[model samples]
Target: MTIRRALISVSDKTGIVEFSRQLAEQGVQIISTGGTFSLLEKEGVPVTGISDVTGFPEILDGRVKTLHPAVHSGLLAVRDDEEHQKAMKELGLDYIDLVVVNLYPFAQTIAKPDVTYEDAIENIDIGGPTMLRSAAKNHAFVTVVVDAADYGAVLDEIKAQGDTTLETRKRLAAKVFRHTGSYDALISDYLSKQVGEPLPERYTVTYEKVQDLRYGENPHQKAAFYRKPLAASGNITTAEQLHGKELSYNNINDANAALAVLKEFDEPAVVAVKHMNPCGVGIGTNIHEAYQKAYAADPTSIFGGIVAANRTIDAATAALLSEIFLEIIIAPDFAPEALEILTRKKNIRLLKLGEFTSAAERKPEWLVTSVDGGMLVQESDVHTISADDLKVVTNRKPTDEELKQLLFGWKVVKHVKSNAILLAKDDMTIGVGAGQMNRVGAARIAIEQAGEKSQGSVLASDAFFPMGDTLELAAKAGITAVIQPGGSVRDEESIAVANANNIAMVFTGVRHFKH
Candidate 1:
């Protein structure tokens, strides 16, 4: 499949003129369309207009330009087939050996802050995708280029062998399909959003690769990070890495978990996460105070965990943070003095995120997780707890101070794994037990971690206790009050236990199962 003729049409004209000149220098005739033809003619590239080959001018505002049989027949023709060659010769159709095309900026068009529906629809490139798909399908004879970065490779191949190798053609064709596939998916997603369909009969989504990682969760596995182009702001994908080493697989996972809990508080707060569970969390008037309390809650767990703050990290806090062997530190901003102190440590990752800034409005987001052979998509756990949402179900009602601590514990517990228990006092988490096999087991772990601090701490449960055993454990641990989603069949028994132990209990009527 020696190169003789090539079709060149591109919305992005990057290197198109030079690429056309190089192809013409190789004695290949260049056929172009629309603005591409005008620019090549003006640049003295010796190009043929698409109308000259099709014998028909572009119509319907250029939407119907390249859909004719002349274009498709040229691309789809089998050079080795007798019947196809006979039909092509009889029909006066010529083969298009190479296709250089890029689609209209549909994604960029819709990204405008004030774009109209009509404007978006007009930007969809029908002819571009059609020609690329056709040329890519007949890749044994026709070479296709959808990315500007591939222009050099294609030219090198042509310069060396007068045609692209079959392997290169296959690689380029696979790339074309992926490009067009993501193109179509973006259009489908945009249109579905316009129609307000969360789950249409058909589904399409795409992610742009950010970088390849050293390894996945374990050393033997390969891994890469990808970002959803349209993901909501304030996520780990959108954070700016200001300092330190590249984030590991566990670092990203733990940092994201910490941020999810950090977003639950508007006050100055810090959340320390280990292995996707909150080990410690605190809220206070300032970041230093919050960090101090969070570190005090579980110094052992916070030693190597990821820390995320809802407020700018001040110098005093940064000094304390620098003392720990943390994997990562994330916040809305870092004071210059704080950065000076923390940057001295070489291995810790520092992420600056504007998403947690006060000016950015918190919006509802969809949570997606991959399963064995399918996927799970649901609304994020943005549901929050407040004083009004609490319904006291025990004979003892929580005092004002006790209610505050219970709510704070409730917020932190939601981010922990299922069968979770968190103990809180003075707006800081004293102990967190997560991912236990049983509620009593989780309670026992949390109680042991809290030590003497567990005596006055209020307890927060991610879900209701199936029996009164967990509450009895909490009571013996000296937990004064408890908050949980009370809908279990044995809820009355749990309430009876709370009453017998003179412990205050509240039912939130909502469950937060992180798993």
Candidate 2:
């Protein structure tokens, strides 16, 4: 049988009433539970309560509302099968052709600062997921709509064809599985946290679909944007694009790296990122000056790089930016005139990420990296090390200025892929060596890029140097001090090499391994 009945139960009621009314006009019966039942009745739509259809009153504080056999049998019944039809008819069950449900606000609930254990447990949904899966399992005979945002498409299809096509049912069933899987992942995460295990049996991540990209990194590869759940108030994903064209795969990747680096500084800061690595970073009195200094650090690299500013972009900054061919620009706010001026470059993406300071609103369990046949998963690198955390291992204590440069180098090195080396002067990154095969190779690249700028510059390594050869090379480049997360067995060899040249050395005691 075609979908002639829909069971609508939702925590988010957006477009529900209008959608129900439209469904009613199409002569489809609307069955609902508790709040959905009263709300639909108030909206002047004739609705059958789930309790009435189940032939049992909703008990256990509404937990037992839609769990009865009548609902599941109706949703799962195959109208084309004689046995299924006979059983449903014997049980007096009307086929529930569509299921519209959204789970409880569990993510939002847990995010509250004072959320209690009871509150978190109570928000775990029971009846809604069951109905969604039931309808989805029988997708050949039913359509399951989990997100209210899909209401328009489902309604439009019914209105256009007088019934949804078979293909639409299968597509929606895929979405239903994804929805329930994400929901189950959240529950598992919350329960695991309560048990206080460093790693769980299964690590899961839930991301909402943002958009389907034109293509992935290449034209042949498929790709889509999935916004991480529990995003901060001002995260880039939550930011609005006030002007310009849609963002590409590389644009978003580089822009996110730029924003992440910019979040490390408190002062007015700017970061220029190319190929998911920071090419230049600077801090100054104001955003305008910061952008100028960051750009001046490496103008050639900043040409097509994403620019991230910690503060608002004023007219002065905008005017100066107009001279460059930037891919995207992100800021806390953009002055009215600044936006108008920036909009002149119709292809440049202008993003306003207000109040989002990259302090990590919600941390994820693990990161997934794909290979040809399978993926590698590991815990996210949330290990943070500050200046106070470093231990001065060399005889010579680093001067205040040198310490600042070391910290600056440390910040940039973490963002770079291993094996990584960064050389910094004042408070900005001058040169970086990333994704090399060995520490010595990375050091050579960093020194070559720094050139004369390597003199008196502090060097930071992402991991401990296995040999003192890199330090010897860095010393030849006139490097004064070195900072690394030192746990190497031959750590003394590196320290001896640094001390031999009167270079100050500090061990962060924590390594940032970005593979």
Candidate 3:
């Protein structure tokens, strides 16, 4: 299969002209359609139009341009078959030796704020994908190129080898299939919104492979980084460390978790995370004090935890942070002096996220977990329950301080696993019982840890009380009030138990199931 003819059609014409010129210089005839052909012709590159090759006009506003049997027959024909050559000769079809095609900007079109359904539909390429799939299917005979960045490499290969090898063609075909699959997934996800129903099949997600990390949680397991398709620029994947060793899998995960939690606060804030959970979080007038208070919350947990700051890290904050043996630190900016002092840690990761904030953006889909042979997917419990949203089920309304503690407990409980309980007072978590089999056991653990502090502290449950056992435990622990989403069928029993204990209880009408 000598590369005598090639088809080039692309939406992103970044280096197409230079590439086409090089192809023409190599005596390879260029075949293109519409915009691509006009651009090549204007750039003084010889090109044959699709109408001349297919012997049919591009009708229906260019929708029915390249979806012809002649075009596909040329691409799909077997080079080794004598019958294929006879048929091609009879039909006056020229063999398409190479195909350089890229789809329309469907993803970018829908990303526009003012995008309309018609506009998105127009961007969905029918002919381009047809050409790509056709060429990709016959990789043994056709060289398929999808990305513009591959033009230089493809040209070099053609120059060096006279034609792309079968192995390279097969690899390029694999890339084409992956590209089309990702494109189709984006289209399906968007169309699902028009029809008010969950997708009948699995919700498809597309992520570009970013980098292969050293290892996963342990040094033995293999790991890699994948960036989501629609993620904004300057995210962790695109961040430059400037100094320090390459990030580990655990370091990247913890850093992202810390960033996610810290970005929620509008004020200057710092959060330290360990094992995918926030161990310490604090907000102050300045980042330095915030970091100090966050580190002081639990120095043991902050030992190798990931620290994230909402504001730039100054020299003062860096000096204080330098003393701690942290794994990673993420922030919008860092002073030059601060970075110099921090980089001395060698193995510590210093990620600069720049001044990018996506706090108000709609949360990405749901959290998914996989067990043995099945998977569970649900919306993330990042939802906040405000005081005004709570219902005073009992006769006694909560005091201002009690309401604040209850809200604080509610927030903390959402971060814990199901069957969770948290006790809070004076804007601090006193005790927490997370991931227990029984609700009563979780309640007891929270109360016991709170000790005499439970006398004035408030308790928050992730789910409704099943019986009076948890209520009785809270009463004995001297809990002042309790907050939970009321959904249990035995609501009367729980309410009666709360009233008898003389503890104020509020029904949030919203559940915060963390698991």
Per-model TM against the reference:
0.95, 0.90, 0.88
Give the TM-score comparing model 1 with the true structure, all chains together.
0.95
For each candidate in the order shown, give its overall lDDT on alpha carbons.
0.91, 0.86, 0.82
Task: Report the lDDT tens digits of candidate 2 across residue range 48-69.
Answer: 9887788899998887889988
How much does candidate 3 score in TM-score? 0.88
Model 1 local distance difference test score = 0.91
What would the per-residue lDDT of candidate 1 be over residues 1-515, giving only the tens digit for each residue?
68999999999999999999999999999999999999999999999988889999999888888888988999999999999999999999999999999999998898888999999999999999999999999999999999989999999999999999999999999999999999998899889989998788876778888888999999999988888766656779999999999988878888889888888888889999989998889889899999999999899988889999988898999999998899899998899999999999988899998755331345666667899998888887778767998899999999999999988888889999988999999889988889998988999999999999999789999999999999999888899999999999999999999999999999999999989
* Candidate 3 residue-wise lDDT, 374-480, digit = tens: 77767654566567799988767889989977876676576666788888776656666777899999888777766777887788998999887888888888888
Off by over 4 Å in 3: 232-243, 335-341, 354-364, 368-375, 393-396, 440-455, 467-479, 488-502
In model 2, the runs with Cα more than 4 Å from the true position are 2-5, 89-91, 149-162, 357-365, 372-374
What value does the lDDT take at residue 268 in candidate 2?
88
- Model 2, residue 420: distance off in Å is 1.9
Q: Clashing residue pairs in candidate 3, if any?
A: none
Query: Where is the poorest 10-residue window by lDDT in model 3?
Result: 357-366
Which order, best to worst by lDDT? 1, 2, 3
Ranking by TM-score: 1, 2, 3
TM-score, cand. 2 vs. native: 0.90
